[model samples]
Target: MVPEPEFRSYYGQPIIKGPLWHEPHMPAYLYLGGLSGASSLLAAGCELTGRDRLAAPAKIAAAAAGTAGAAFLVAELGRPERFLNMLRVFKTTSPMSVGSWILAAQSGLAAVAAGSALTGLLPSIGKAAGLATGITGPMMATYTAVLVADTAVPSWHTGHRELPFLFAGSALASAGAVAMVAAPHREAGPARRMAMVGAAMETVAGEVLERRLGLLAEPYREGSAGRLMRAARVLTVTGGALAAVSGLTRWRTPSVLSAAALTAGSLCVRFGVLRAGRASAADPKYTVVPQRERIDARERNRAHGR
Candidate 1:
């Protein structure tokens, strides 16, 4: 049998530097952006269905989340102009550039929708703006996943196939939970359904990611990140189940609990992912071992072809 290869790097230093994104800022931005993105979609759907009660909360949530996320992002960037600078040119190849544009569009559109909803003026303009957000909403929610996966971080890069789904699920779950808590129970049926679907999608995608990533997945299941991830799972599952029960009973107690749990769980997912990426980048084994294994596999494939 072939012996297992030892993992190391030059002078025991990390093969790649860990990301500098600090606590509360980057992760908060991620969570809020997801919430905003999905809320925009929910608002648009509710508006089309003439569910004005539900649409009001969703519009407000979308506007608030987007604005807050931008503030956090700006804080992380250390300068307001740094964000504005990104808008100077549209680089199709750069996820950062494209993401900046998406954020701008969604934020502006959501703000307009919320303004119209609140002021009771230009209802037509509000409807048009809310509808426009549907186009940018999904992009806002999942673009961050693509941006991170494009990097060399083992934990983030390896799960590229499933990360987008994970982020999208997280976004929808957060938005649905917000709507469930903010809107009337009768008008919140669709929100409850969305919460369940989103929770299930996030859970399944997370499982698939863990199974596919062998060694790289350790970061997500070990240390501080692991603790957070475990908590997230418990909260998400419980919240999703309770959402169904709440829908059946139409009780305030279960609905509030479910909303709180789902929202917290979504936040945990973002923080845990950032921590996992940092952990993977800090360890040379995460970078080197997978590369060597891929190389060995490629050589074997070539031999078989010959």
Candidate 2:
């Protein structure tokens, strides 16, 4: 039997550099974008169901969150003006460019909807705008997963299939949390249900991601990333249970507590993912070893020519 090929990097260093994104910027952007995307969809649903009270606040929150996320993304680029430069090009292959366009559309429509709601003007136009976000909203929620997974990071790349589902679930949870907290008890039923379903999706997706990654998932099990992930699991489970019960009991305290926990858990998930990617990228073994094994397998296949 042929032995596994050995590999080494320059001076025993990582083969590829990790992302340069810093704290409170990239992660915050991710959280806010996800919140905005899902909230916009929820607002549209509430509007369709004639829950004006819920729709108004949800629309406003979606606009605010999307705008805030955009600002954070610009800050990460080192200058607010640099964001404008991205508009100069439209590249279908670039996730960043596609995301920028989607964000702009989602934020613009949400802001218009919220602004019209405030002035009690252009009711039909506002509804149209809210409906428009429904198209871009899901894309906004899930595209970030592709953006990150497209990178060279071991953890991120290997889990590409599951990341979109994970992010989508997290987005739903965040949106539901905001809606539950901000909307009145009478109108918060859908929000609670959404939170419960989202929590389940996130938990299941996370488990699948870890299991499929095998050794690549080590980053999520050790160090600060591990701590955050563990805390996220606890918080997600607790929040989901509370949300499930909150619907039946209709208790304000349980609803609020559940919302808070779910929101915090979503943030932890984003941060944990970022940290795990960094950890995976920083370790030379993750990059070198997997690639060497892949090369060996390819060579074996070619030699046999079966």
Candidate 3:
């Protein structure tokens, strides 16, 4: 005879509530933040290489995106005024606090870089600001993964090791897309390489995460999250390949298309990840049973040893 399965509740509830905000706002913010960070890096690289024209636009875009995304993030918080509470205390264990500081620094540096670029009167100072922005930009792009992973959400928290790489890849692709749209071929080549690197990293990280997650992976492999993940994978891979080839060829149209595809793919990834987190949080099975079993197993092992 077999024993009956035990059912558990999540916080004494069968189903979890969804996040208050809609998908577009949060996911769009994620995309914009990444785009802004990567743009800063590109700007710094361009300035170093004497590509002032490319650097100028990249700086402006980075500032705009960082500012806008930060605003959106503040708005998303239930108590907008309490957003400052995040900065009041710094906890290394809390990704939210860390991310807030990173974004704050990224935004400030990007603003300085953009201002200098526009005025042209502070070249040396602007160069310094751009350099600082570049250094923090990658962290801004990738830290969101840490933020999501630090949560109790099964899908995201379980994939903590890979989320940073995934986000970094998406950020790089986004920057590449903007460069392809704005810069000349000579200046855009490096952006293309960055995009390719980002795309490859995102793909590999996502794949490893999916494989390692086991039951938790269902959120990413099924339903709306699954659909979005599939789309992201295809677009990122195909667009990256095209961008890589375009470096050797003078085909401007294909390059532009590839950039667009990569940008779209990155957006898809953000939304998919957000949805997967929500899904993981919503299901009692994801939250309760596994944890309970782990605790029980640990207790049993201790008792057996005694």
Candidate 4:
């Protein structure tokens, strides 16, 4: 087995700088964006399948979430022009730019869909708008992962492959929570199943990531990030299990509580991811050790002439 890389630093000071995003703004943006994206897709699917009750509420929720998240994003940027400037150029290479475009389309389509539902005007147009959101919604939900993981932050960069799926699951769970709370039990049954599936996917993905990462995963196991992640896991699992039980027993109270837990857990997961990125960037070891190991392995490969 290869030896662990030793990382030296100045009195254990951080090598890389932490993210400058502030609380409630960045995390809230992430949560609401994901929730809106997933809800949009849910609305589209429900409408296509003749679940008008669930579809109507989901469209409204999607519009509200998207509009609120847009506000939070602008607040985080600290200026409206800063966000507006993002639309000046479309770059396929920049996740931020791509996300902006996606959000623009998502928010507009969601609004139109919601408005049509409310005003009973141009019903076919509303259905078309909802269908369009189904395309943009998943992109909005997952691109934030690319935005975060593309940074120099160690935890995020190292976990890039898993982050998108993690965010997708969180989005799905949040959407399910909204559906369960807003729709009738019969209409919400599919949402409960969605919540359970999303929870399982998120939990399993997290486990696989931490297990594969070994030492690099330390930031997720200690400090504030660790605490948030632990809470997310517990809440997500408990909520998912309760939702599953409710489906079997047809109980209303458990379903409601499960929705609340799942919503909270989804938010916690976003916060945990953000904190982990900060923690990883704050520690020099996270920046140095694994990279040094990769360099050492490459050098050894050259020496072997194979």
In TM-score terms, which candidate is top? 1
- lDDT for each residue of candidate 3 in 1-306, tens digit (9 for 90 to 100): 999876766465535554555657788889989999999999888888988878887898899999999888877785667668888888887788888889889999999989988887788888899999989998888888887787667778789998888898899888887887677777677778888888898899889989988888899988999999999999999989989888888878878888888988999999999988888888878876668778999999999994
Residue lDDT tens for model 4, 271-297: 988988898999898888888789999
**Global fold similarity of model 1 (TM-score):** 0.98
Ranking by TM-score: 1, 4, 2, 3
- Stretches > 4 Å off in candidate 3: 1-21, 78-80, 292-306
Give lDDT: candidate 1, residue 269: 93
Query: Candidate 1, which segments miss by more than 4 Å at Cα?
Result: 1-5
lDDT of 1 by residue, 149-252 (tens): 99999999999998999899889999999999999989999899889999999888888888899999999999999988888888899889989999889578
Cα deviation in Å at residue 41, candidate 2?
0.9
**Candidate lDDT values, in order:** 0.94, 0.91, 0.85, 0.90
Write the residue-wise lDDT of candidate 2 on 1-306 in tens digits.
Answer: 999766566787777899899998999999999999999989989888999999998899899999999999998999977888887788999998888888889989999999998898999999999989888888889889999999999999999999999999999998998899899987898888889988999999999998988889999889999998888888988999999888887579999999999999999999999999999999898987777778999999999994
Q: Higher TM-score: candidate 1 or 2?
A: 1
Query: Model 4 Cα RMSD, Å?
Result: 2.1
TM-scores, all models, native as reference? 0.98, 0.95, 0.89, 0.96
**Candidate 1 local lDDT, residue 279:** 96
Instruction: Show pairs that collide, candidate 2.
Output: none
Instruction: Please estimate how well model 2 matches the true structure, expressed as its whole-model Cα lDDT.
Output: 0.91
- What's the distance in Å from true for residue 10, model 3? 8.2
